[model samples]
Target: IENSGDLIRAINLNGGSTMEWLVDRGGGQQIITVTPRFDQDAGRWLVGILTEMVGAHTERRSNPPWVALRDSFVNTWELLVLVKQGMSGAFSQGSAPQLSGPIGIAQIAGEFTREGGLAGWLTITILLSINLAILNILPIPMLDGGRLVFVMLEWVRRGKRVPPEREGLVHLIGFAVLIGLIVVISANDVLRLIDGRSFLGG
Candidate 1:
């Protein structure tokens, strides 16, 4: 309930009336009601509440809970690295495996289900998640981690930030590279579909 109030305040600050109303209604139902005059004030109140809750939760989870979490993350990273190396090596031996567009992925999913049962489909989903995570972490502009890198650098530099022009150029180059990769992968996927053979096998 305390966390919810903070979330509602943040939502109100962002010009969201529905959440504000809900919060108001919820507060009214309680014995002590604290009404905020401005949206920004409500947002700050909510953020403060959230900070307290998060701090408490973190303190509580600091020992044993975090150990399990750390182990899970390590296992996930190990799995990702293994799968990435295996797939890359397999593709590098010959032509790379094709990239799939939305339609292609659906087709592949249906085909996998028909050919190899539920286990094969599950494997595909897991592989796709790993691939997505790796791709997002690539040192390219316009990605979450890429932007986050810039943010870290800016913080380190204190006064200096990456110039907008340079940032724009980097993002443009990254976009072009990504597009070229997509095109090449899509072509390979199309060829594999037509020829009925894995591109890497050929």
Candidate 2:
């Protein structure tokens, strides 16, 4: 490829797949075949090669507001699809997905900020926000979706609402369970850190 961006895009499009490259190393050209693997720490596919910038190039262009909005919608939809697929895979595997608690998230934020500057920080921030929104809407007790479920039940009962005391008890129990889950996940994060494992559970 002519540039790092092109190479990265190609790799991402290929995912973890084998690829062949033709290269000239002053002794004529040669073909190299390699396979990429998914790196949990890096959160991408890698072939264990590094590139250095020989020069700097910059280009600036402005897109119409409509175009930018369209792209934003498209990207958001793609992210949602990926999240759905990941959740499906995790369920099918009969194993819990790797999760990051506060400590792990903080580590990721710092790494991204250092490695990618403002763009990287903003990207991570946006992703976290999206994830949080999704969690908030999940049909778990003590969440908005849980309350919506109750509302639906009320409608099914011809406007007969659930007893206030019972609803409160359910929410209180939910809160306790949620806190317990947080504690457990946070403890896992600490143990991973002590073992020098990636906070991302690599």
Q: How close is candidate 2 to the true structure, as a TM-score?
A: 0.70
User: What are the root-mean-square deviations of the candidates from the true structure over C-alphas?
Assistant: 22.1, 5.4
Clashes of each: 1, 0
Candidate 1 accuracy as lDDT = 0.57
- Backbone clash total for model 1 is 1
lDDT of 2 by residue, 80-118 (tens): 755664554455455565677898788888777877899
Q: Tell me the TM-score of each prediction against the true structure.
A: 0.50, 0.70
Best by lDDT: 2
Query: Residue 13 CA error for candidate 1 (Å)?
Result: 50
How far does residue 16 in candidate 2 sit from its true spot (Å)? Answer: 13
Candidate 1 residue pairs in backbone clash: 6-46
